[model samples]
Target: MNAHNIDIALVGAGMGSESCLTKEVKNLIDNADIVFGAARLSNSFGDSDRQNVIDTYRVNDMIEKLEEADKDIKAVFIYSGDSGFYSGAEAAYLRVKEWAEEKKKENADLNVNIEIKAGISSVSYLASRIGISWQDAKLYSLHGREYKGRVPEVIESARYNEKTFVLLSGASDVIRLTDEILNIKNVILYLGYHLSYDDEEVMTITSDKKEEFLKGEIKEGLYTAFIQNVSPETKYLSYGIPTEEYIREENVPITKEEVREIVLSKLRLFRGCTFYDIGGGTGGVTVDVAKISPDIKVISIEKRPERTELIRKNIDKFGLRNVTPLTGNATETLALFDENNLVKNDNEYENYVREIIKNNPPDRVFIGGTEGQFRDIIRELKKFGRKIRVCMTAVTLETRNEILKLADEDTVDDLSVVEVNISKLVRLGKQHMMKAENGILVATFQL
Candidate 1:
């Protein structure tokens, strides 16, 4: 707006100039002597006249052209989406800042003006179109070529809550990311690409069905997918089992109701919390936790090769998006904790938490069986101080004695137990009676 100066405006034309452009933005753009924007956006101008125009992927090029323009000239640099919302304006601002800094050092008499304008983002657009309440959905961008850690937390969190995820990026990584989380079941996916563009496309698929689409079952390339949880009604069985069907069970692998309730109670499992259930049995505890709190992530870890398959099946049957089935023993499976707790000084307990959860520690630790080495597992967990709640179930008096011995002492804080007796109702000619199944619950909380 200044006279005798190069005034730069970073603008977002929104999706298709017709839908996103506000009258205020249109006015500023109309008055500019020079305009710069993406090729697609630049073409959207139709027959509009302009003194000069530039097209390029990078905003720095646009800023350079602005710097070379005549003094007192108005120039508008445009980008897609809202300039403030994952648009090119952010990079433009950085380049402009650097250019301004360099100019100030050379000439105190010269001044440059820059302003960033707001626009709608694809996140909001896709959310609105899908009828998702934007207020409930968390937002993130995996399109940043420079970002790495962005998608994991976002994906995990979404799986935790079954939130509507609106991703704006290449379809190449969609399957790869899904493969990484195949253990999580009942996820619905929707991918939207080039929104508001002539070639724009959107598609919907379940995570399990992603394979069908990935195998070129769908011919579309530039497309986005919308996912929802629509697992078929589970096949009735005496108990929950893996969907794979071929998985062989060993060593009393089914989870007793008593054990599951105590595990859920102690872990304090809830939506949005991530955890690993070591030695998950029939995925009962993990599935229960996930179902009870859809936002909490419950991953089942089992070392028995046969049991691993069962865990996966159970995940699918229950439509548990929050549960992930992992196959491995305590030592190798939980190495993250081992590496975290290993320090120079054992007495440095505070450093223990700083090393573990700060780095990586399952929010809730469930020691259903302890893989035949209870002492070592308990010791490894104790090293982490607190911030991890550990629960265990013991069937034998000796194992119970060991658990009690550990709980009796403050090796881990807030240790408690629940001994439950559950009985099944057998219909005797329209009558039912209770049969008791006994189990002990041992829980210890820290931090």
Candidate 2:
């Protein structure tokens, strides 16, 4: 061993210093020359003798101190929770490895060794206390991540996952997320707060008192995780949201659940994909697309004023923040840029896409209400290059043939058409019967 070498060890401290420290980790920490970690975590070692502990949480500062130390020293970095589950060990390991590489490049003889030891994870502990298996739980965290675009995932988890757990922090307080879920009225929450601590509290909240429970004074404990059961076995995973769920206007056209599911299936959207629901009608497609993922941006383009308002209502009812309703003809609205840069020329649609859509070309476009400008819309999509996906739905055979003819002329390859006829149940009098909806053909064109 080099006299000037530094030996670093990353040890998971579980929840805190009060308890849950493994014997091996405790021994390694006790034998170290100097320790570094968060203030509370480092101080938890109770290593006051020789004043050898540095109670700081800065990674760069630790690296610098390790480099500046003169003598060969045993250094250990402390982290909370298990080193396997979103712990700080991986981050510290990378920084230390980079430092070791740079040092080796400078002196070729420097010796550095890093050892990682695991500890109990809060999620596992919580699951044990709740008497449930975490093997199937969906893990998520708002501890240091954005919550607006992430809530939909957790909500969907509750809907489709038997046990879904989310780590809570200042970005998305559990109470705040629960309040948002209140609008959905479908989740049953199981909470674990301050796990393994004296103040640890575990509880369950059902629909009966969820509103009042969320409204109550809820404290942020030492650590918080929740298991939400939306009963996936009994629920559809949001793609096939029923037709009657949305707020629709009298005699206004709305995409039925069956057709909407197929349209979204054809679109096959990914994360952060931009979707255009031209002739959005009741915003069913837009709402369903937005529900697919929180980060997916959806724009509803409708020329009708009443339908636009109805779309807005559906959006509000669903509590979706990723959708925008633009009221204007697709031919005209797709031409307009943002508030400050509306395109003056119809041919300047590319400029409109750049200025208004934030430089994001439509990843997928669903045309349900393009009047006679289908040819123009097809031409514009083809002009944009091969990165956009287009799916158009037509109720009449003539419209379907017209779109197919345009697709052929545009050199669009392998265009597939799926005709969907939804059979819904209706009451004829005392008994119910299947009501066959109009057979609609969905034409999908890939660029």
Candidate 3:
């Protein structure tokens, strides 16, 4: 759109100043009869005609002023970041449409044209500065909004796993989010403030100390928080471990690598899932569940007391929030989770899970190591109406027998058992393949 034909051009000022301004945006600012922008930002429009400029935060007021301006003169409204992405342009367009409609009702003849010009968004700039790409990162804007409940899932996901996150308007959310992060343990935090400015500041911290800093106990400047997993040097030092971590040492722990593949595949977890790895042997399966898909919260139930304690210790080390460790028989705890106790629903066992996913619905459901009581758990899972894909692993003959029984049952929508075995390449004078002593039977149900 040509500025001369445009009644007003809403331009972006990039993130900071004139130096970051695009040449086209600079020209528009220079030639306009009047400029509309934020007070702090209007000063950046060097060489602009000051007498005709208007500086205010309210777009409605600006629209009114623009409507009253001389018809032949050009007016430019400047905004920070891209006009198309969470900028004021959408609000301005709606307001202008409303004004035009009201004028038509009054039978007044007025032509106030409008157009938008895009600019580089702060997300792109900030990500570029950190040598990260926006293609995979989850983007969130906290400006003028509260993120108390809506933020926990994403924050926990970013904190627990290897992923990237971009945030705007983070000045207020850092504290509450940090609290949520602490509950998970061992999260890494990076804060960037006044980016691309001469007074720009950045700080990195752990979830344990995020609250102290956000509370102003630690002096810092305005910034955005980037929460990520701890690197290799500290990987074993994470605050929370998946309940699955406990099982490995008990001589019954699911291998971390094996569990990771199974849980990720069964859950198909993209966002959130409340998974219960019943009969969790030490918690290895649960840890892999939480670690591989940070979004899937795992609640593992083991009957042994020592195993329960081990799960807690591991959770503290890995910093996983998406896991809830329960010590007791799987059947009893599953019974206590009445639908009434859930976010919603009643009469179904999965409602406890359903209520979680209803309030926080899971993308997948897993019942790893359902041996002797496989049929009973399968019956309970059926009550949730099949929104979840239930997966279970059987290793021993007794467990495999239970799985075979489950596979033959008609109560479930569909059931299949897969036998998996692996071998390692062994070499002495010659090379040979040695069967990895472990074998597993995986049962899956779809409803």
Kindly give the number of clashing pairs for every candidate: 24, 0, 28
Deviating ranges (above 4 Å) for candidate 2:
1-4, 46-52, 182-188, 228-246, 256-262, 288-297, 312-356, 359-361, 372-386, 395-441
Can you write out model 3's per-residue Cα lDDT over 1-447, one digit (the tens) per residue? 222223677888877656788888888888887787887677667335454767775778776776554346777888887888668887887876677567555444455667788887777776667666666666666655556434645654565355445454554566666565545545566667776678776666675665567667533334555666554122343333443335246365554455447545754555555776776665666666666555556777777777777776666665565677666655545544445544534546444443443443333666665546666665555555547777776668887776677556666667766787766567757666674857877777775
- Score each candidate by Cα lDDT: 0.63, 0.76, 0.63
C-alpha lDDT of residue 47 in model 3: 39
Q: Please, what are the lDDT tens digits per residue for candidate 2 over residues 255-332?
A: 877888888888889988888888988888999898877778888888888898999999988767778787666775
lDDT of 1 by residue, 1-447 (tens): 223566778887877646578777787778888777766776564224645766665766776676665466877777777777666688878888788778766666567788988777776777777777566655555554422345445444555555545354565556555554444566666667677776666666665665776787433233333444444233232232332332335653766654555566666655566776778767767666655544565667777767877778776765455565666566644544555445545545334433433355566777777756777766665655557767777788877788778656766667676666567778778888876666554655563
Maximum-TM-score candidate? 2
Query: Candidate 1, 95: how far from true, in Å?
Result: 12
What is the TM-score (0 to 1) of candidate 2?
0.78
Per-residue lDDT of 291 in model 3: 64
Q: Select the stronger candidate by TM-score from 1 and 3.
A: 1
